[model samples]
Target: MLRLASSFLSVPSSLPHLLALLLALLAPAASAMELGIDRLESRGFDSLKGKRVGLITNQTGVNSAGRRTREILAKAKGVNLAALFTPEHGLDGKELAGKYVANRKDPVTGVTAHSLYGPTRKPTPEMLKGLDVLIYDMQDIGVRSYTYVSTMARCMEAAGECGLEFMVLDRPNPLGGLRVEGPPVEPQWISFVGQLPVPYVHGMTCGELARMLNDRKWMSAQCKLTVVKMQGWERPMVWRDTGLPWVQTSPNIPRADSPAYYVATGIVGSLAGLETGVGGPNPFEICAGKGVNPDSFSNTIKNLGLDGVQVRPYTAGGFSGCRLVIDPKAKGDLCVLALALLVETNRASKPDLFAKSPADKLDIFWKVYGSTTIRDQLRQGTSVQKIAQAWKPGVEKFREERKPYLFY
Candidate 1:
């Protein structure tokens, strides 16, 4: 327990004041954190006021009071909410992954919502015609390959080219801020999924990433950036500690803690023949294949001595394997868990897991992993421990490089 207050000294002399103080001390401390949108509202939407704003967000962009940021901005006095933009999923987040979402008029605000996942991934000059600023407020899952951050980067480039200001309403990295894992994106593997040079599980908020991209000149052009920082959020605080409600970021990421599981299994899931509970009730929560023995898989994972995660025999979608229960508080590398699963799966059932995977699937795997080297190494019988050890240098370098941009 993190207590909000420790001691109350110099008590009020009056009886009523003293009683009220006692009541205040006796009441349970609130852990409610003010998000970027909440803070912006508290400031009377000053940055957005009198500005023609283009909001890049999805269903996840809501204030502390559960009010949509788009609606708030649309109705805010003197704020003209000119346009809307959505990332991989559509504005409502009902669209499936990798599916193209067509542009449509937002029924509520009547603003034309542009699909950044469709024919045009970046904002066109016509889309930026009358906008003064592009405000991004979507929740990111803290994985480099998730693509929302990539959309943000491209929008920043467009903002720079059009001379429009860019604003990011900061949100918490659900994986917290201390954990950096896996390899940085190699130059050749850079794509929409691996846009930034950050590691797979880079632990920074959207605002921090924006600042770093602009300052580092990672994007082609730099935009005038403004980050409306959150209030009462700490680096160690994960989603559960933030006291904010979880809006499903996408179709499969249906819970607040889903990001941890995604990091644990997303890369491995990219390979064909492995079922990661995508269609079932628990998406990205299970590692199972057609011929896997559940007991052996669970026991092997347990013997690996990975922290912050517990494994058990589980069956889902006619595939038998282990269900991962990750403890966000513990200091475990989720990507390492993915490697462990890959290694164990190869040892137990799929000896040809990598060798037999389809070329397209392998392509996706390498792109998501940020390099083809890891796959090649794994195929050549590299131990999971040694592979994880290899990631230390790059992860450490990123930890130092990201120091200047971290807000919390």
Candidate 2:
């Protein structure tokens, strides 16, 4: 028995070697592929074995190989995938923007799909009563006011109330993780759109944000949490780096450039007469308000010497709206791009540009871009760079405070 035990400890690791070889054989051949829940197959569903799971996901919650979480978990070994929950876009992502979802069975999987939007923006006790775990896997646009994160936070609270474990199967932030920009939301004015004082473009993954919210007690403090971290993802690589295909998480964000332009031009979504390219090829890429001075705005940015971006002015016609396309060929820094455009807009247009309401634009800016510095700068003729720099201290402080929660 002693000799057998010695042999077992010394030269008898065939099982491990075989497992390693098998994994190597199964190793992905390509880079930047969609690294979603499908990767969890070999990682095992043992944590959820025999437990009913409620999944909150949307059309973008797909594996690199193009499989949905619902389909994957339904067939996953030992996982009793019970219920399906959806955010703004509905379970299949067919609903149009602002369209409320009603509880219904998934026509494809026959699983009960609950709407976490509309009059009730959270999961109720009935939804959690039979579930052992609640999993979230939506693609976020990297903006604070995008609503997906809010849904995640609300669900976290609901899961905690029912003693259910919450799991975040993270995907990339789409805008990448290196560039944290914009101002932090003020806590006093916190709304459903802006919870937890995160920036408009917080450079952390959804999983990291989930942990931060829990740590900050922005959500319930006692919720059980687990995050499935992404492998091979680094901060420098944007969605383009992930080699993952772009899935439009919302109607307006048609492409990766939409968020790129979002930092600079999306605030224009709040200005009136600007069509905002909602139905066009590039949503945030196009901005137009009635009586917008396209030539002056263009010349203003040209003189800013802001490195890395060029905006070409054009008219979208009556419904198309006069707009600017963020020149795809240009490249440099994002904030510089934003500052240049903002300074130019303020110089070329009236304070009325900022004063316009929903008839003129969307509802995102009054909340996300409500920085006192920027507002005062526009009011006092301060340069956009100066305005942006004024907010940098706050941004730096947030970055330092948020470091502990970063997974990468």
* Among all candidates shown, the one with the greatest lDDT: 1
> Where does model 2 exceed 4 Å of error?
1-29, 32-36, 318-351, 358-364, 370-377
What's the CA error at residue 147 for candidate 2, in Å? 1.4
After superposing candidate 1, which stretches have Cα over 4 Å from the reference? 1-28, 316-318, 349-351
**Candidate 2: residue 248 Cα off by (Å):** 1.5
The top-ranked prediction according to TM-score is 1
Candidate 2 local Cα displacement, residue 26, angstroms: 22
The positional error of residue 370 in candidate 2, measured at the CA in angstroms, is 4.2
* Candidate 2, poorest ten consecutive residues by summed lDDT: 320-329
Quantify all predictions' global Cα lDDT against the true fold.
0.89, 0.73
Give per-residue CA lDDT, model 1, range 1-408, as digits (tens): 234232333334465777898999999777668889989998998877789999999999999878999999999999999999999989999999889999999998999999999998899999999899999999998999999999999999999999999999999999888878987778998988889999999999999999999999999999999999998889898899988889999989999889998998898898877888886678999998878889988998888787888999987567888999988776877888888998777655555677768898888888888887876786778988999999999999999999999998
Candidate 2 local lDDT, 1-408, one digit each (tens): 999877765765676886788999998756644354755664787677888889998788888777787888888878888998889878766676668988888876778888988778888897788899999988887877777898899999898888899999888887778777776677654656676587667888899999988888886544899988887788777777677778887877778667777776666555554556666677766655555576766666566664556656655474322344553323455555665655554444554556644431334555656544465667787766676676688888889989999988
> After superposition on all CA atoms, how large is the RMSD of candidate 2?
8.9
